[model samples]
Target chain A: MAPRSIFLLSSSRVHGYEFLEHAKEHLKEFLSKRKVKTVLFIPYAQSDYNKYTELVENTLKPWGYKVEGIHAKSNPIQAVLQAEALFVGGGNTFVLLKALYDANLIPIIRERVLQKGIPYIGSSAGTNVATLSIHTTNDMPVTFPPSFEALRLVPFNINPHYLDPDATTCHKGETRDERINEFIEYHKKQVLGLREGTALLVEGDIATLIGDRNAKLFLPNKEQAEFAPNSDMSFLLNKT
Target chain B: MAPRSIFLLSSSRVHGYEFLEHAKEHLKEFLSKRKVKTVLFIPYAQSDYNKYTELVENTLKPWGYKVEGIHAKSNPIQAVLQAEALFVGGGNTFVLLKALYDANLIPIIRERVLQKGIPYIGSSAGTNVATLSIHTTNDMPVTFPPSFEALRLVPFNINPHYLDPDATTCHKGETRDERINEFIEYHKKQVLGLREGTALLVEGDIATLIGDRNAKLFLPNKEQAEFAPNSDMSFLLNKT
Candidate 1:
């Protein structure tokens, strides 16, 4: 099996950046070394597949990259097998997972990405499905998937668009930090809270925290470690 | 069915109020006309049943109401069968639904409330499950339940702790309004956004929107209607 190559972005867009303008350079550098130029886009996370596919295609086409929508293809699994790179856009995590299950492409997508080492790019809900399960996503469960389990491509779960608690906010619902704490009470897997403008670059058993902010790490029975951006987070690769 | 006696409070607690304090007067009036003196409290939504039950017991015990924890009972179904009133506290909706399934109490609880007409009180997560399905809940799906389908006590789904878009806030993820809009894209139910301090008083075929503030209503195709606090929203009770 080839080494894992993946980019799990906290979100596709950040403050002061056009849709994916902020991650333009990072995305280019991540896939620059790869041989494939044509990318297969999975627009299943949203209800409007045509609009979602067009938005992603427009963003990457300018970079001399060709993007294709998987929904428009006749054979999805075969498309994944032949694709050079895979990009899963963000909308709703439950919607994305259900579409993946409905298409019966979970196994082959896992094979092409993990076994064949095709570069995988995910943002927000897209970034969420890269983990062991979809337990940590912040999106509403508008739909139910067959199981909470995901591709298991990564060792732990990822909480994308992880925002810090704003003490001034009057909303009484659980804050992001408290929600993750509650999740750990029921789940044992370590979770990395990726703040906006951050991405986890995974390559060959090594995962590095990239971007301008520090990421918070939550492990069972331990204090949350603040790992600064551009820090070596490959230790997370160690399956406890 | 004894005229559908149910009150779905948006939250158990409101700002500047003690736990369940804001809803105390409403609770007293809802169950006052009935003869049942003992109320059964299901603290399954939260982890600490002992503390949860005690807190609820203290609040209602002043009015000569006896509150007992269902978790402490030997046979939960029989306990529900004999209970005068049913109170479901708010915490996490997924946790509440999963525990309901685990205890094998869904059917019995359904019979007692729907068939026998026991006074049913629910707040937050509790209130979310009183609807047809839990698809509109704002709480995280920390645990999986037998199904998203609930008691079907109410014809439409309920979005508890439903806050309006904060014009001052800059958080970019989908707002509460956007989330419900997305839900309507896939689901065909009307979702009423119950702000804190608000509730849907479901009695027979009438659901009156009661509170100091106006609640936002979302239908499939029509513009969102703004209903006043005392507005008779019983029309929602009509199965669309």
Candidate 2:
């Protein structure tokens, strides 16, 4: 089954922006279109679950989002099943994946979101989990997960908060491009380098690039192409 | 047994320096003092193992040490057992760890170097494999390993190529300091941030920080401290 609605944001907050402020209107529109009443915020990525949940709830409260953290629930899997919509906030991807595994909620979440077409919104680490694997994440492996396998709602993985390589810098660390190329070298998955303030909204088979920045599609051993904002990236939903 | 003699370098070359050129004199002095004749080079971190091996060999050739790649040996364990010294070069830590696990050479190498006191030298990703775990690495997880567990040669892990947080940079990505802190938030192990042109020379139980730049030590929930060059970092070898 294709993903009904999956909004993958590059970050929760862009430069000079409030926490997920730019995404609030799009998020409300998305949820409204789907008639979503209840939104479950997965605060798995953050170290402080309470703080994360409170902040998220407060941020979306003005937009009329009945936001509640899954961490506050009794049975996480059941929470996912009951959630009208899901919003996963960003932090460390490894810790987030580990939390999913620890709660044994991967199967249920996949069923609830992918199969049932429950609207899912993710940013940063959250966006990483909606993809094929968390291998392309820029976050440190502060914790180990059961596996790098994600929901696989989309065929390709996302490299969020993507920054272009600094030409003048002599930093020894591999740039986003080099890291993604290396991933492509070993893995067959194409990676979407989604810059800040950008997102990919996947509805069934179509995935569209949102925000002002051009999304870079990194194909293995192939030249990367940039798609302008609001462009039809639906082709990404298809397996290459 | 604790690591008898382990020289872990942050990188093979600092900016403006030749391959391992900065540490060449130190390497010669280390090998000469130990009276080591044969050094087995582990080029697993690099994709092109042949080139990595030859480059390392040529770099150390002037010092009159026999540097050979372990990949060329029929029985790697036997080669490790007979080796007077071991050198692991840098590239990708994930690839290096994966190779170590694939070859099942972890135990043998541990036995030879950590237990038998065979001198070992590793730069960048190679140095990461000598720590308690590779959880603090700055490299990409291009490949998955059986576990992040390393040789446990040192009490704590080392964050190689540690860069000072640039105050002027507008980059949204987490700084090296932030990454190390995040690692400590979830993990109990301390992290030694070894900067470029820096090396940690461990003999018996004494580990000394060698380089001109000040190395940062990150302890969980504790303020990070900068250790001046050539400071006695032997306390790091002792488990807290």
Candidate 3:
């Protein structure tokens, strides 16, 4: 079996979705060679079926990919097992988790996508769950009331909406860097502070950053550094 | 047995020692009229045990209340069963949850404190845990990755460090009200948007807002209301 690919898109605010267009092209090319039809999963949109399905169908259909929204009430487990590709859209992380949990689709999705080698692409909450845990998500727990347990797709944490320090302003509140630093200090976990427009492309044990410039790497007890995109997806894959 | 009176503080910015002072007063008041002398529980100051223990003891000793800060090596279940009151201080919710999980203290604390009716007081992470869940905490999960499961001391969710909408702000980002509104839209859970110096006093399933004027009450599908600190506590308690 070809190694499954996982893409974690930063939140949509920073052109995260725009980069998805390029990603879709690559995905289409990969799937075409395999003679497989791409299948998109929108677990977060299950609550508002019509709206979410329309959004997913509208976005993926244009790329010549077949997309279907799986509502939890209707054989969600079967949907996961049969899908060739899963694309979880960004929304409220808590709401997404609740739907996943309610539908009992968490384990099924994990089994099929993570262990079964189905390609997975997630933005925002979708990306948030693609980590060992969803503790570092920028979205307030209020948006989706998290259970903290995620899909464990990656070993390290994902700091989506990774913002650089603003030097011109003296914002007394904790900066994004400070917050990630605090997480590193306590948890001692490696984190990928992905700026918007950045995506981590993972194929089996190889994980690489695509789009934008270098992303900030955060490791416990080590100084954070910005490294060029495409340096090594291996760091992410090896950790898992 | 007399119903144990518990005070759940909603403030997060207080220094450890400063908090210890207020805790000592409350403990003294509780113990002065009771036969209890010792209080066993976790502290928010995990890294610096000696310093935290000193601060805890300094205040408790003066009031003749024995205070023991459980160590990483200590069995939290054993400590909870023996303690008269459980004091959970404010800190990162994720860090606290990790410690609680590592120590296997959550079930024990819930059993002893909630089921057994041992007096409990929490602030910040402590306060967050006192609610039905910790899903609404404003603290970045990076600093304190949360599981969102809490002690359910109250039926409602809590947004500690709750700031009123500042009309003067020019920043395009969502305000605190807007964030809570987003949360209400998704979860439809009752949230007590607590300001600094505010406390939620719970007595026998009754929760009253104490301190600060006009704390905001966010209800699902209802208009937000400004509740005076001295307003009837039953209004909140009855919602459950």
Q: State the DockQ of every prediction.
A: 0.64, 0.63, 0.22
| Tens digits of per-residue lDDT for model 1, B80-101 | 9889899998988889988888
Worst 10 residues of 3 chain A by lDDT: A11-20
For TM-score, the strongest prediction is 1
How high is each candidate's TM-score?
Answer: 0.98, 0.97, 0.73
Per-residue CA lDDT of candidate 2, range B158-235, in tens?
999888999986556677787888888888668999999899999997888887788999887757888999999998
Q: After superposition, how far is residue B117 of candidate 2 from its true place, in Å?
A: 1.3
lDDT score of residue B188 within candidate 1 = 62
TM-score-wise, the better of 1 and 3 is: 1
Clashes of each: 1, 1, 7
TM-score of chain A, every prediction, order shown = 0.98, 0.97, 0.87
**For candidate 3, what is the recovered fraction of reference interface contacts?**
0.35
Worst 10 residues of 1 chain B by lDDT: B166-175
User: Can you list the residue pairs that collide in candidate 3?
Assistant: A94-A144, A94-A145, A95-A144, A207-A233, A208-A233, B94-B144, B94-B145
Poorest 10 consecutive residues of model 2 chain B by lDDT? B169-178
Q: Could you give the fnat of all candidates in order?
A: 0.36, 0.43, 0.35
Q: For candidate 1, give the lDDT of residue A125.
A: 88
Q: Rank all candidate structures by their lDDT, best first, as comma-separated numbers.
A: 1, 2, 3
Q: Give the per-residue lDDT digits (tens) of candidate 2, residues A74-181.
A: 988888889999998898888899999899888888888778899999999999999988999888778878788987878888999998998887666667788888
